[model samples]
Target: MRILLVEDDAMIGEAISQALKDACYAVDWVRDGQSALSTVHRQRYDAMLLDLGLPHKDGLEVLRVLRAKKHSMPILIVSARDAVEDRIQGLDSGADDYILKPFEMAELLARIRVTVRRNAGIAAPTLSNGMLSLDPASREVTVDGVATLLSAREFSLLQALLIRPGAILSRVELEDRIYGWNEEVESNAVEFLIHSLRKKLGSSTIKNVRGVGWLVSKGE
Candidate 1:
């Protein structure tokens, strides 16, 4: 799923972005609230991680504007502001969850999964296509009752494909989902990962759509 991270602190933003990428999420990060507001208005994201302290415009204003404009995407306030009033205000303004700074990456990921699933009206953490099963929490994949190992990039790629089985995903789309916006992508990176995944999952598991992209079926 796609996540927009609006954090002003460079170190904390970098760390959170890396952790989210490692957990198989497509992340787009911005430093200030103005850029955050613009992006939120332009594109659709599965969820957002917003920090309260921001430049140009504070994060609360960003949240208020988004809600005013009727953007229903899940927003999780991940700020250093841990005061009770801050938490209450964030929720009252439309945040789905409030996560304080110095929080565990695992907990953040768990909250992300819950928020995304809840928004999508899905009650389970596992996504399945036929005999292929993907557990988001464990980052584990199993096909036909046999366990399989995958690299971090491969897992992210597969997760993006499995999320909407049978839908064609272009190379650019796959790259966006598998890597953070700032990561340098090789020309044939998606193809390389696809090749590796096919080798392990069997050639028929993923199909090339000629010039369009690649697809995996939703049924076993």
Candidate 2:
């Protein structure tokens, strides 16, 4: 999954970015609300981590504009604001969830997984097509009861396809799922990942529809 991270504190932002990347998310980190707005408008993200106190534009203003534009990606507020009213205000302003600073990393990750999964129309924590099961929270892929590992990008690509097994997704669509704004993609990046996944899972696991696109073979 891809996430937009808007935080001004250099240390906190770096930590959050590293953590998210380690968890298999492609993240675009911006320090101010204006940059956040620009990034969101131009790029696709599964969710956002926004801080209320921001340079250039206040975070609440960012939220208002995003909602006004009918943007529906989940937003999670991670701010120093800890008062009851602050939480209420953030939620009322269109944030899907709120986390105060000095929070546990595990809880933060859990909330992000829940928010992104909810946006994907998923009610369950694990996704599977027959014996191939993936656990987003654990970043684990298991086939036939045996555990396997996937690189962060490989995992993101698989998750995108697994979201709608049997639905053909074009190369451009898969690229968007695996990349963030401002990142340069190699011409055959998607194909490389697809090849890697096939080697790990099995050659027949995914199907390519010639000039159309790619898909996971539908489970019977």
Give the 10-residue window scoring lowest on summed lDDT in candidate 1: 174-183
Tens digits of lDDT, candidate 2, 1-220: 8889999999999999889888888888999999999989888888999999999999999998999899999999999999999999989989999999989888999999898778878888887777588888777888888878788888999998888888999999998888876679999999999999889988888899999999986586
Tell me how far the alpha carbon of residue 215 in candidate 2 is from the true structure, in angstroms, after superposition: 1.5
Candidate 2 weakest ten by summed lDDT: 130-139
**Model 1, span 151-216: residue lDDT tens:** 888888887788788899999888877666567999999999999988998898888999999988
* Per-model root-mean-square deviation over C-alphas: 2.2, 1.7
For each candidate in the order shown, give its overall lDDT on alpha carbons: 0.87, 0.89
Question: Model 2: residues >4 Å from true position, as ranges?
Answer: 181-184, 218-220
